[model samples]
Target: MANKNVIWCDEKTLQKDISGKIYVVTGANSGVGLETSKQLIKQGGHVIMACRRVDAGEEEAKAFGDLKGSYEVMKVDFADLQSVRNFAAKFKAKYDRLDGLMCNAGALFSGDQAQYTKDGIEMSIGVSYFGHFLLTELLLEQLKKSAPARVGILSSVGHAGNAKNRYKVHFEDINWKNRKYNGVDAYCEAKVAVNLYAMELGERLKGTGVSTASVHPGWARSNFGGSGVMMKVLRVFLYPFRNSITNSNEESAQTSLHVLLSEDAPQHSGAYFSQHSVLYRDKECRKGGWPMTSPNPHAKDMEAAHQLVKLSRQMVAL
Candidate 1:
């Protein structure tokens, strides 16, 4: 059955001329973020490329050739809370209206040894969830002021966990201080928390004209896993069938573009939009056609959602 709500948001469908709109795309130098930024700029939307490495962002922007819109690079290390604060302040000082914010930066460490951000939070949660939490809080007023603005969270299907093990955020030991650490599990926890946050945020922002949604861009081919030995080996091993297992950056980016640009997006605030990978992992992940999908059971627990938001506020001092 086809999903009528699934609007294949490609260049052809996204025909709106957003000449003066401004968007912020974190991790804009590569992967889905890069493609999202590229497509937005091509459609006359100004993008603030928020990256950890400004130089890399500058390089990518330069290679983008001539665009209908414009872009500028800004530095932000999601692992550092202070850096997030600084970035928010800088963004607010320069731009009055933020048309959209794409929380696309993520961190995935390898091995059982736990990694910590500069702020002493677990690295995966810090970068993938908390930093965005704080950044959104700081800029929320601006989003509200902009009216009709949007916030797109780039989450993952890993949050759903598997039949054998359902993922949960360990509120008591979120930093993995007591239990043996697993980076993959930590990533799952962060992603689930992100969905919960989006749900809570959407509820709170109702009628504020600032809607939010969590989207899975499929298993996109991106520089997510750092250049580690395991990644190198996995890349080589999967090279032959990569097209079947993973999505191209552009294909994955459609979900982001949908939440950011689609007129129908606001109606589905707090929803989770997914891709072909959700139905058939063996099929090639193509661009667009994001049908609404169920997330982890935890994502729909209003108590958990509210609790997470409360904890996040306390952690970020919002």
Candidate 2:
């Protein structure tokens, strides 16, 4: 199901000039994050590349060539809450406004044992969901000050796993403290949290010029998911048809670009977007597939979304 009903987006989908606009992209030193930042810069937009490794980010930024827009690298480790807060404070102090914030950094753990972040929270949920939560919470005011700003969250089709029951959040044992550690399930649940957060955040921000949405970029080949045995098996399985089955980094970035730059995206603010052609923006800039409902019923649970926000605030000490 993850492979079906998806659209393949290209450069033609987004041709608008965004000169002078300011955006912050997490994990921007590589993969989809790098591609997204490159395109935004090509369109004359200013980008703040937030990365765990500042040196790596600087190295990549140097290779961007002479582009219409510009970029600067900042450091933030999603595994550490203090780092996220520090980045937020520095950003607000340096920039007058923020037009967009892309919560694009993510990680997957396929090892047998559970891993933890610097804060002791489960690694997958900690880095992929909680850090971004704290960053967005801290930047809400700046986004409001710069009305018409947007938050684009990068989700995954794995959120709606290939399992028969789909995926559900384990609120009672969110940190994997009580259950057998399963890395894939942990990743899926973390993604579900982000999607739910986008839903609830949209509801709370109504009438505020800032809007939010979550997107699923079709499975793209990258150095993500690590080199655990499970991942190796998956790679070997997909290697035969990886080209036909997976999207390239540039192609995977289309959905994110469309959601952030499309003029029609505001109306669909609480929705989930997938990589299917049906959800793409057309030549006239009208909505194609978005406002697309998430396949997971649990992701649509408004009550759960609210509870998640509450728990997240407590976890991040917000």
Number of the top TM-score candidate:
1
Which regions in candidate 1 have their CA more than 4 angstroms from the true location?
1-7, 10-13, 278-291
Q: What local lDDT does model 1 show for residue 167?
A: 80
Q: What is the lDDT of candidate 1?
A: 0.84
lDDT (tens digit, per residue) of candidate 1 on 1-318: 223223357655477788999999999999999999998998899999999999999998897899899999999999999999999999999999998999999968878999999989999999999999999889898899898999988777777776566687788988899999999999988988888888899999999999999888877778989888888998899888667667778877888998998877888888777755643222332322354555457766778889998998888888
Task: Give the 10-residue window scoring lowest on summed lDDT in candidate 2.
Answer: 279-288
- The collision pairs in model 1 are none
**Which prediction has the highest lDDT against the true structure?**
1
- CA deviation > 4 Å runs, candidate 2: 1-13, 227-240, 277-289
TM-score for model 1?
0.92
Query: Clashes in each model (backbone N, CA, C under 3 Å)?
Result: 0, 6
Candidate 1 residue 15 Cα shift, in angstroms, is 2.6
